[model samples]
Target: MYKFLLFLTASALPGVAAAQSADSDPAEAALAEIVERQDAARQPVELPDGRATQPVTLDAATITVTATGLGTTIQSTGQAVVVIDRKEIEQVQGADITRVLQRTPGLSLSRNGGAGSFTGVNLRGANAEQLLVLVDGVRVADPASPSGGFDFGNLLTGTVGKLDLLRGSNSTIWGSDAIGGVLDIATCGGSGVQGSFEYGARDTRFAQAAGGLETGALALGLTGSWFATDGFSAAANGTEPDGFEQFALGGSVFADVTDQLEVFAHANWSEGTLDIDGFAAPSFTLGDTAETQDTRRLWGDVGFAYYGNDLTLRAAYSMADTERDNFDPAAGSAPTFASDGHSERVQLRGEYRVLGGLSVAFGGEREWTAYSTSFNAREETGISGAYVQLGWVMGRLAAHIGSRIDDHDIFGTKTSFGADVSYGLGSDWRVRASVGEGFKAPTLFQLLSDFGNPRLRPEESTSFDIGIEQGQRGRGTHLALTAFRRDSADLIAFVSCFGATGGLCTDRPFGTYANTASARAQGIEAEAGIAVAEGFRLSAVYSLIDAEDRISGNELARRPRHSATLFADYEAAFGLRLGADLRLVSDSFDNAANSIRLDNYAVFDLRAAMPVSDVFEVFGRVENLFAENYQTAAGYASPGRGAFIGVRAAM
Candidate 1:
């Protein structure tokens, strides 16, 4: 893996080096010459709905693809969604994806400690494992994890170009884990040169570089970044400091094979090391132990897409690999734990226009997954699924319906379905409603681990939402309100083996995984944005959630009941930009039965930037401006009052 990443880096060095020269790069000129021969490959296709394929751009007013797994305008879709562009990310000057996501409505985040530590995310009152995360259309969940979830701590913001979040259940559109919502991330790519470097508190350093070339029917891009920090201690009671380091590399290529066929490929690799902290040791002594973890993640996809006047078809293959090792130097023993897992998927899908204002989509997918660990033997599983969906629109009215059937080797077969409708009231007002069913198959670890339960059933959920929105054209003003409810049954949880009998206790001998849990969550989300002046804007979002375990009647852990954010930004003709935001979270429980309490907290951030020339800019920001001391997780302290300054260059 290291060798592969090295080769990719070496291949792109000449272009990066040439970018630093005062004269135009000869390599770039050569690329142009090569592209000149492929000018007659791909052509734009017009859909029956009058939508035309164009160069991908970050225009929030236009459309998004994540909501429906197909192209649809934000205002036209019945689902609630938000788009965050690269410019908005830079305005916040944050390096962690979790920090950026916390500013959105109906989302909550908790971390074990500072940067690079274990982080948990809750969307619309759904658990972390219930939220699906996608990077460039590839699922990134770790099958080896107890809950088969993605870790947001390892996703840096330096290479992210766009983020699309759909807030509700749509398992029929995606797959498992969509019971919470979906976070779709797009990496940086364009026909230009761009990079940044920064120095901050705690001996921190950061650097990023990207290069791209596009001509005729072909385009290529590469981006890489490095980050390191002597982070604060992960445990509040420990004096030893923990640190983290990361390196990431990504590349993509697109080529038009013919007027109707286009081929594309993308790959990303990330490896990092993080310091770990332990709790109290024997005799009640604070465990300032020396522990560390090394983690590696790799993902790639390749496929061909064909576009016809009335039909579109796509076929693709993708895979994700994750490996991690944990060690304790203080104990002077071998690695304490390790896990390796991988997932591979193949899918074929097509969309055809059935009439003037109606379209239909059909697809089939097959997936294989496997996991290995130090203590457990390797295990594998497979699933196959097929689905169909219909979309229709007539002036102010739009509707969508979809259904899917998934067959698992052990769980037999299960079906899910969803439908949504929207009606536009005049030009500025609209109302929407949706209902959906979702299911999550047991994770490989959950079913095959030491505490395995081969007879466990899949978790199932039903969700519904209704909302109203108002938007003003050419006025930069929008307001939306939504109320949603979700009920889940047969959720998996570990149960003690004392008094257990028969096959349940035969697997683990200690505790057994069982379908002994049920839950309910309901929430209200409100968002508003307006142009305060010609160059200044203000936006805010507020969420109220009631999440509880139905059987125990206890509030879910680590989910705040009330959370809100307010943001303001301004830009001047003189190349100056200013931005600030405030985030507020109410107190919530840290453990089941609502016994442990985590305090409520508020954080403030400020940033400013100015361009000296068209190619260069300088910027700075202050996080936790008031130096507030807070903890999102018990015994874990959040960063306070840190300043970062950086310079960016683009050509």
Candidate 2:
């Protein structure tokens, strides 16, 4: 790895020397090149229903072919879905990954302090561990036991190009812990010179810069962001911690291995510090602060694809070494490491078209993960799985069905399967139905977790969803309403010991991550977007959620009852745009006992943009404009009202 890093550094030396030849690079050569390419490859396909559609929204429903396996799109199927573009992300700069996750429907995000703190999500009301997250299609999740949790804080906002939210049970195509759904973050690819820099504040002080450049077939991109503040008080009132951060850098090389094939090689790396400035214990305040952690990620992926008349053959391998070191409190004290995990995945898949409107995709993959820690524990796990999917469309009826079976070294074998049927109801209406089983394999953190029991089994789930979609195209509207119900067994939960015996158990085995009685989650998702007129758009989403354990009858922790968002944007002549939105969440409970009640809150945001010329545009936004103080995070406080203004210089 060191050698590889050195080679990359050496290769980049020329660009550095060239930039240094100039005075501060004021010409902004990079941004001009990036715009040239983004307009070239991967054209957004027209939405089947003629609404706002892009390659991401339409293709996420199928995992057909890619580095991970077969890549698919949601718009290609009837599954509930949503896709957010890089433009949106860039416009909302300074917002953490968790905040970006919240803007999407059927998903909820919570975080601690600022950067690198414990930022997590309650995806569709499923356990945090039950929701799976992927970066460029490879899983980026906590190796800790199941229910151990994934960190939203680790993702650098600038490195992300787009986010695809495949709503509903996705275990059938994605495998374990996909009990809820998948959040796929595809990094910016096929780069040319592109970069942006800005200074802003929204309850905090911050600065950010990101850019990408390409030479020949190799493209390199990097982004860095920093923030500081005396944060707001907790929900109940206490000094919110001061969180500081530093994360940046990513690069990729794309070369056509042959006229009919190509290969992609990429790497992502970052380092940061998180100071838990808040006090959990007043008496121990002197030594109370949580250690500042140093973090890092090194990953690589390579693949070859052959495009034939009616078939595509693809194969790829991906590997990543992820580490986080916890430095203890006090000056010059050594840190006790929490975990250092490594993962590797290899996949082979082929897609063939048997006839018009009919295609079949099949593939197999193997993944290995190992965890090493200074906490007196370690675990190794492997997953071998194969999947087959068929899609058939004739006239107004389209049908899709898929089945996958994953064999684990432990926990025996598990299978997930689902079928979807959609029929075009005349007069601008279509109806669809789907049913499937999902599962979340216990993570090493859950099974061999430091304080965990080894006898635990994988959690199992089954879900059913039915929906109606209707709308017009281009100048029309798109709408979908879906209702879902899921039943799960061997549900995992923290088994509390209470008082003195409780706090001592830091591992999952001690008082948490136990296989509990069964559980269930039922909910409704409604989404709609329309272009009423040229350059004018309106959109809204609503979700009513109910999540709980059947046996314990305890309301699952951190699950909110209802969440909804409404947004409107208007585009006028002469390159002018304006938008506003409102987000609402119902009251929620924090623990199993339901002793903590968080009041419901609604937030409003406004934005406006105008072109100074064809190549540059000045934009501004006001978040939490009303200054309503609220907490989406548990004990961690949230910032109040804030504002920012900037300019985008595009070619």
TM-score against truth, every candidate:
0.90, 0.83
Residues 1-651 of candidate 1 have per-residue lDDT tens digits of 443443343333322111211112222222222222221222444545565433322143234556677555666578878877666777777577876787678999888777888887899888888888988778889888888988988899877776779888878877777888888877777777777777798878777777788787887888887878998888877778889888898888878788777788889999999997875467554346688989999998999877665666778899999999999876667778999989999988776767655778788889899998999888999888888989876566679899998999877898889888888775468999988887888998889888888887888889999999888222488888999999999999988887677776865568978899999999999988899997898989899999999999999999899999998889997969899989999999988778889988899999898887666778898888999888888877788798999777766
lDDT of 2 by residue, 1-651 (tens): 432432233223221110110111111122122212222232333446664322221212122221113444333466665666565665455546755666666777666655556777876788777777777666777564245456777776666766767666767677777777777776654332333333356344444444455555444555444444444333334543555555556655555555456566656676666665444354543223545777776676777655554566667798877777777565457665566777889987776666765778777889898887777456788999888878765455667788999998877798888777777765568887777778877777666755555666788888878889886211268788889888889876556654425342543323645677688889898888898788888888888888987886877777888998887778788768798878888888877778887778888888887767645566787878998767665656666776777555422
- Once fitted onto the true fold, the runs of candidate 2 whose alpha carbons sit more than 4 angstroms away are 1-73, 145-148, 202-236, 278-290, 426-428, 471-475, 496-513
Best by TM-score: 1
lDDT, each prediction: 0.78, 0.63
> Weakest 10 consecutive residues, lDDT, candidate 2?
15-24
Record all residue pairs in model 1 with backbone atoms less than 3 Å apart, i.e. clashing: 41-258
Q: How many backbone clashes does candidate 2 have?
A: 29
